[model samples]
Target: MSKSFNAYILESRDKPLIIMAELIRKALIVRFQDKRDKMKNYVGRICPNIQKKIEGLKELSNQCIPKWAFDNLFEVKCHGEKNIVNLVAYTCTCRKWDLTGIPCKHAISAIFFKHEVVKDYVSHWYTEDTYMRAYKYIIYPIYAG
Candidate 1:
């Protein structure tokens, strides 16, 4: 006697954490490419000291995104609504916006409502100590014999 066989399949959904990581990855890649293009056309090539600052800007830019993302950002929607906009810097409720600091459509709209808050939301690496230290040192030139 012969028996017939049948197979069944199940679909899977990605977890929030996995989705957030992917978004971050995409944002980072685009940011890198844009920075590279800017560096190439940089006019500081003529000055050694200025060049160093430009080079430093390149290196610093890599680490200059933000810390709030790592820690996680939170938000609220309506006056009585629960925190719907739970877009922590790294994990946006919408997924794409949070992962990448590009700001989601919703965030962009919200920003218009609260521009000051949004401006503060943007992470600035130039304010960091490391970059400040790099700018503090004098760039004295030495003559070659």
Candidate 2:
């Protein structure tokens, strides 16, 4: 994807100065607009992958049983297996959350048990604020001499 994008940019730069500036400006504007629309649509929402994970978690929460452990920890049982969840550490015995930076169903059930916001447990990288911050810079058009 990046290779194709870089190639397009390189080709654009080789065009006549007036056309090059216009092409680059249009490309940047389209990209910026797309990102802005995405950010607007997902305001107060987590990343798309995490959203799907949360949906999976909602279903799992119904099937799993949660027992409180020490502070911020839980023991969840599903399908005859026990998985430990530590809310403070954002980890699960299955290690899915630790490996993927997204909460697993067991952890989600634990959070539901405690009546906490599941989105809070999600990583900041998945937050809308972080997405917007990544694209906050304006791409200015350079005047062709």
Candidate 3:
């Protein structure tokens, strides 16, 4: 995000354009390496951030009540609202699951009713494999002239 770059801008100020550019590049490489290292220690199928979100959703799902409608279909009642969840289709009437690629509380309740793991229902884009692939390539370090 811009917040990362914004913090380095002040440090690069008063330097020549080329030097500033190199400084920013070095900063980014270090930042990326740190991220990669942090991810290496994380052991989960889904990325840590998304996993945290799922954990929060799991807690919320406990409040929902799921009723069997038909095969792969469930009617979930949560907070006085009714949401239809289709396990096979991976969809919820509330549309939160469709929008976020992560199952919403309603869908999670239905998922729990089926005795299935919520992580398996998450989109591949949030998988650890995808995340590692994104940061796999190392940035070559440039030496000072």
Candidate 4:
């Protein structure tokens, strides 16, 4: 990452600081606009990368056995390890869901047991709308002569 930034700096090293800054700003605007346009027609509920991760976890969830404990609570056993899942809170004893904003295998099993849509439980931050919102603002170009 540092090397990439260094290359950008090297390209504008002969110019004054103000000119260098403007060049970098213009480069960033172009990059951001490209990204925004690229995702403009996306229709997925969640971002593709995050959905892929969730699909992988869904397969793993089949190995887990979920037992209903109480309202919105479940005990899941997987590979001889026990975990607690709370649907309302969107948490698991393993803490993976709490930290990553993505449900862990245990939570997946619990959600499956309840016949709930796995994608619905995912954090809004991983949604396609949120991803688009992140690149929504444009950086207008300036004549940096």
Candidate 5:
């Protein structure tokens, strides 16, 4: 599950930006470092089969968004047979994102709707490592010196 999907669940409960961002951060860190914010190894496993599917969709060279789905930023229809619902910006209608901080199948499907996004990176959830790595070593704590 990607971090953005997780964020969408927050959408259902009316999650504040701060809370949504926090969950995204955790997911990313785990993906990049194979560890969590507290430096602990992940205890669970995401489906490798799903990972491969996400990869295949990303590799497409054309704007191959399936015809059955919508293109707006939010609420795209399912590809075909999949009952999953996709919420483009906030969450997928399938409610997986709402139930848990994870990108459901629909969210991934929406991402494919806009093939420009790199699927491998998109599907990989966010984590604190990316956040800290991006902004760390910036102005130190005021009390430090």
Candidate 6:
């Protein structure tokens, strides 16, 4: 991302401008606004990739059998193996959730068992609010002298 930003800055510097810094700021604002607009109507807090993971969890939830294991933990039986899921910790014994910031099937099941919202369990980094905050600032172009 930094590389791309640097490249953009270099490209902008090559152009004739009364104030290079102001031009670069305006360009960045436009770029960020475009990206933010695309994500403005997102269905939920998580990104598309994490949303795909959640879809997979829905399918897996149907196949797995869940047993309550005290607190926010659950023991899920899938494909003849028992995997532990701790909803509070946002972890699965399978290690998928720990490795990736997204929650795994077992954890999703545990969340379902507790009647909780899956989006609530997702990492805050994937939230729509966070995405909006990333591009919250707007930069207006300065008048060319």
Best by lDDT: 3
lDDT of 5: 0.45
| 93: Cα error in model 4, Å | 0.7
What digit string (tens of lDDT, one per residue) describes model 3 on residues 11-117?
98679999888887888788779878988999888998999999999999999999999998999999999999998888999999998899999999999999999
lDDT (Cα) of model 6: 0.81
lDDT of 4 at 140: 76
What are the runs in model 4 whose C-alpha is more than 4 Å off? Answer: 1-16
Q: How do the predictions measure up, each by TM-score? A: 0.28, 0.73, 0.86, 0.84, 0.32, 0.70
- Model 5, range 1-145, lDDT digits (tens) per residue? 4586566455434557776655555554445454233334332233344445545544531232333445534343444333334444445456655665455555555555555343333333334344336434323222324
Q: How would you encode candidate 4's per-residue C-alpha lDDT over 1-145 as one tens digit per residue?
A: 4897688567876889988888788777887787677777666898878999999999999999999999999999999999999999999999999998999999999999999999989999998888889888888766548
What is candidate 2's local distance difference test score? 0.85
lDDT scores for all predictions? 0.39, 0.85, 0.91, 0.89, 0.45, 0.81
Off by over 4 Å in 5: 1-88, 116-126, 130-145
Which residue pairs clash within candidate 4? none
Q: In terms of TM-score, which candidate is stronger, 2 or 5?
A: 2
Residue 45, model 5: lDDT of 33
- Highest-TM-score candidate: 3
Distance from true location, Cα of 13 in model 3, Å: 7.1
Answer with 2 or 4, whichever has the higher TM-score: 4
| lDDT at position 131, candidate 5 | 38
* Candidate 6 pairs with clashing backbones: none
Q: Per lDDT, what order, best first?
A: 3, 4, 2, 6, 5, 1
Candidate 3 Cα misplacement greater than 4 A, ranges:
2-16
